[model samples]
Every structure is written in C-alpha cells, then in structure tokens.
Target: MLRRNLPSLFRFSSSASASKPVNEEKSRSVGRKAVSTALFCLTGGVALSALDDLAIYHGCSSKAMEKASKNQEVVHAIGEPVVKGPWYSASLAVAHKRKSVSCTFPISGPQGSGVLRLKAVRSGDDSWSTFFQSRDFQILILDAVLYVPGNEETQRNVKINIADNIPSPSSQACTRCPETRSPGKQ
Candidate 1:
C-alpha cells in the first residue's frame, strides 16, 4: 500500500491537474478580451452611422429637396411631388470646409421617376453651427437638374438662385457644374 501511494504522489498526473485551472483561466481571459473588442467596434460603428445621418439631414441636402418640391416645373415634370430613393443609391459630396454641398439622389412621383442633382453653398458665418437650426445655414446657390421622360427624355436644369438673383434663360446650368456651358457659347 505504501509503495503504490508513493508512486501516485510523484506522478505527473497531479501536476497536470494543478496546471489545468491556469490554462482554463488563460482561455477565459482571451475570450473576455475578444468580447470587449467586438463590443467596442460595434459601438464605434453605430456612432459613425448616427453622425452621417445627422449631417445629411441637417445640411443642404434637405434644403435642396425642399426647394425642388416648391418648384412648379419640377412638380409638373415629376408629377405630384417628391419621393426619395434608397439611401445606398444616393451620393453626397461636401467640400469647402462644409460650406459647399453637392447632392445627387433619385426621386419619384405618382407619374414619373428621375434623378435630381443639386449643389448649394452656405452663406454667413458658421458661428452658430453649434446650434442646430435650419435658419442658421442659408443656402446661397441651390441649383438642380432633372431628367423627365415625356414623349422623349427631356433634360431640364433649374438654377434656383437665392439672394434675389434670377437665373437668365441663356444659362441652362450653374457655373458650379463645369460640364455644361451657356447656350450659343459652346
């Protein structure tokens, strides 16, 4: 009995059992770290998405859409009103330190569907940027192009100018969009 008990005491099986808890503890720590990292990434992604949505809604994007809706030509071409397209299909370009914004998005109505492209420049100081008010950031130059399919596809550029400056009939597109030239010029 003494000889059998002595062999058992010196056996490596006892040492292996002692180290099992340490290995399990190490694995638990690794799992915790992985979970923490996943949570952190999820939080960051949510925050960025919220910020993007906020910027889109409170910026010139909404202002341009609002101005388009009020235009009778746009209403007649597109039909009853405005309907925004899928978020993934829409594109937004912001430049000049957020003073300029260009938006291209799909819109539909009861009678027709088309793409709307608009560029707007912000006026006045951004001193009240911290305050979220639509009144603060005025849209200085809001111009849009509409493609309406009538008997044939008709392209119309609506240069909706603020600051009491009316768009001349010869200028079909805004200077901001360089691709288009004034009529009889090019």
Candidate 2:
C-alpha cells in the first residue's frame, strides 16, 4: 500500500512540472513580441525622416530658392544663382490643414551669405497633399536678410523684399479691428 501511494505522488509532481514549462514558454513569446514591435516602430520613424529629407531637398525649398536666386536684389546681396550651402541649416514650418509653409534658410554666394525668409500658401486643395507636400506652395512673401562681412551698413546687411503678394494698402479693411485703416476711412 505504501508503494502504491508513492507512485501516485510521483505522478502529481510530474504534472506540476509540465505546467511550469508551458508558462515559461508563454512568457518568452511575449518578450519576443515586445522586442519585435519596438524594432518595427524604430524602422518606421527612420523611414519617415529619410522621406522628409528627400522632400526638403527637391520640393518647395528648392522652388523658393530658385525664386530668391532669380531676384536681382537677392543676387546683388548674396550672389548669382544663390545656392551652395549645407542643407541642414534651414528651418521649416508647415501648417498642415491650412496648407501653408514658412521657411528660413541660409544662403551664400561668391560675395557673402545671408538668411532667406519665405511665406507661401498652396494655391488649391490638392488630392495628394500630406504633411510635407511641396509642389503647390506659391510664394506669397519673400525677404532676404543679407549679412555683409567686412563692410559697413551702407554696403550690406539690409533686409531686401524679394517678392511681395500682400494686399494693397488701399484695400486693407477689417471692420473687426478698430485700428485698421481702410479705403476712404481715416
């Protein structure tokens, strides 16, 4: 009778050990899943960064640079074909829903270097526009702040308006603002 009880005790112990292995296997699988998820998220973020860089390289920034480069005033302040600086030295602000952008970038030429400030708005609601769309930014206002090295204020370092698309002073009438002067109103 004692021997029969011993076998039964051994059987119960074996079943308990088997359940522990199953629990361990489940915990390992959960850990592996967590690591895989983290890796996927990291890769997605890296891809988006690469995409933004590519867009900045070939999109609205380039177009704004082209417009600024073409201006005679900008050319005189900086240099002709006003390009050739590192890409990382620019600031970009994008208004997602309103489809507007404000950009400031460093520009240099044979004579000197300056900062370009530009504000632009998309002409129409485009079907393919996302956060970083660059194709439709019509430049509304462009200004170049030149920094003249080894010269006086008269020689350089003045802000030049490259392009202006603001409303004419004669038509600025916002009834809500009491300080705003309108046409035919003092």
Worst 10 residues of 2 by lDDT: 163-172
For 48-70, candidate 2 gives per-residue lDDT tens digits of 76686557445667777887776
lDDT of each: 0.63, 0.73
In terms of TM-score, the best-performing candidate is 2
Tens-digit lDDT string for candidate 1 (8-70): 887867788879989999999999999999999999989965665457544655666677676
By lDDT, the best candidate is: 2
How much does candidate 1 score in TM-score? 0.56
For model 1, what is the error of residue 148's alpha carbon versus the real structure, in angstroms, after optimal superposition?
A: 2.4
